[model samples]
Target: MPLDLPSDSDTATLAETFRLLGDPTRLRILFFCLEAPRSVGDIAESLQLSQSLVSHHLRLLRGARLVRGNRLAKQIFYELSDKHVSGMLADMAHHVREDD
Candidate 1:
């Protein structure tokens, strides 16, 4: 059967998403938030990145809908936007580990 392709706008959006995921720092941040919601401080400390840097990356990730944040009091905790994001990440990780 022939596959249906995305519209040009959707293709551009998907490309943009891939470009956002291409950054090493952003990718690390996404992986860090894979398991559970994490505050900027928690992620920064665990990843050994400055809080400001983490915040910057989070903003971009949030813009791309790759991650979402929930405000709890004065702190906001971030996690993967949905299972689709996690599933894609997991699939890619598995793909990388496969024997060539």
Candidate 2:
């Protein structure tokens, strides 16, 4: 049975967030950002993904407000949007590791 959710629209919104999280690439990207704020180039290099691909996903993540970027001189560094998101990811990681 479905647990009580605020409304259909709210469920849909939450589902959309999960949909974004469902992709392995996106998960990797998000987890990588947990380490520290990262540049697009740095994310690509570390994840071994194309810069274009990383940028594309970053655009989606930015749109969803899951990540925020800061301009440091000419480069933009991205980190989790806030401590709430960061803590959620950390707790989730711990849960997954414990489950294993």
Candidate 3:
């Protein structure tokens, strides 16, 4: 199937959001964020991934505006950028379970 491209700014935003969700690691990171804001260390520990690898995925997610990060003390905490991400994930979860 061919991928659709959004012509306008709004569609472009949607396209970017889809791109962010296309990666499994990014999806897992988003789920982790859904629970609470976490630092790269927290993500690494929870996901059992190396810090460098988690940081790499985080950089892409941040660039896509799917997630936001803030510095507190010495650690950078990340969370979902908007409510839509959580809504989309919830919808996806429902569809996946329906398929089973």
Candidate 4:
């Protein structure tokens, strides 16, 4: 089956998204949020990263629509934006583990 390509601007946006996912820190953060929403402090502590660093990365991820945050009291918990993002992460993980 043939795949239809997106327009140039859309392609650029897609490429930027890939670029964002290419970062190890951002990728780790995404995986951390894969199962459930997590607070910045929790993600930082679990990932051994500074809360500020996690917050910075989260801002970028949120900007790209790769993740979404929901405010609960004074804390904002983040998770994968939708099933599509989760599916992509899962599919990529499977792909990397596949034998040649």
Candidate 5:
């Protein structure tokens, strides 16, 4: 089937989403989250990032609706917002791996 053209708002929003994804740190965060939901400290430790830096990027990702945080006890665990986000990350990984 032919792809449907996106509306102006959708195009703008997609541009914004791509813009956010363009950051290496954000991409690492998303890729890490894809494996499993993680707390801020876990992400910081795993990615070798400062807690405040991770928190800052997480805020932007949360605002963009690209990620969601769940509360367990006093910890906030974050992951991709939904399957679509997961698929997008997976597809991108596949594409990069293809070396095309």
Candidate 6:
């Protein structure tokens, strides 16, 4: 369930969003998904994870509404749920950069 917050709750949402991204496995999944909608098998292969393990992580991501899936034939392809994830990642990278 979504937390009930006052009118100004952008930070709450952002915090929750980042919390979901805190896991390294989840971070890799998000980056891979950002590249293209991919099948569980593809993610497993690329990340060197078993299909079952990848599926488990995907389930968590789906539960958080951070990823979306599309079925093609007997396979399901996954992608980011919205542009917010991409935008947040980009903004984070920009702000977290070190001085030259």
The lDDT of each candidate is 0.89, 0.87, 0.88, 0.92, 0.93, 0.86
Residue pairs in collision within model 6 = none
lDDT for each residue of candidate 2 in 1-100, tens digit (9 for 90 to 100): 8767578898887777778778999889999998999998899999999999999999988888888899998888999885767788889988988846
Model 4, residue 19: distance off in Å is 0.8
Sliding window of 10 residues with minimal summed lDDT for model 2: 80-89
TM-score of each: 0.89, 0.88, 0.80, 0.90, 0.90, 0.77
Best by lDDT: 5
Q: Candidates sorted by TM-score, descending order?
A: 5, 4, 1, 2, 3, 6
Over 4 Å off, model 1: none
Worst 10 residues of 4 by lDDT: 81-90
Q: 1 or 6, which is superior by TM-score?
A: 1
- TM-score computed on alpha carbons, candidate 6: 0.77
Candidate 4 per-residue lDDT over residues 47-99, each given as its tens digit: 99999999999999999899999999998999998577689998988899988
Better structure of 1 and 5 per TM-score? 5
Residue pairs with backbone atoms closer than 3 Å in model 3 (clashes): none
| Per-residue lDDT over 1-31 for candidate 6, one digit per residue giving the tens place of the 0 to 100 score | 8878655477776677778799888888888
Enumerate clash totals for all models, in the order shown: 0, 0, 0, 0, 0, 0
- Give the TM-score comparing model 4 with the true structure, all chains together: 0.90
Candidate 5 Cα errors over 4 Å, as ranges: 1-4
lDDT of model 6, residue 82: 69
Ranked by lDDT, the better of candidates 2 and 6 is 2
Q: Rank the candidates by lDDT, best first.
A: 5, 4, 1, 3, 2, 6
Q: Roughly what TM-score does model 3 have, to 2 decimal places?
A: 0.80
User: How big is the positional error of residue 82 in model 3, measured in Å on the Cα after superposition?
Assistant: 2.0
How many collisions between residues are there in candidate 2? 0
Model 2 / residue 76 / CA error / Å: 0.9
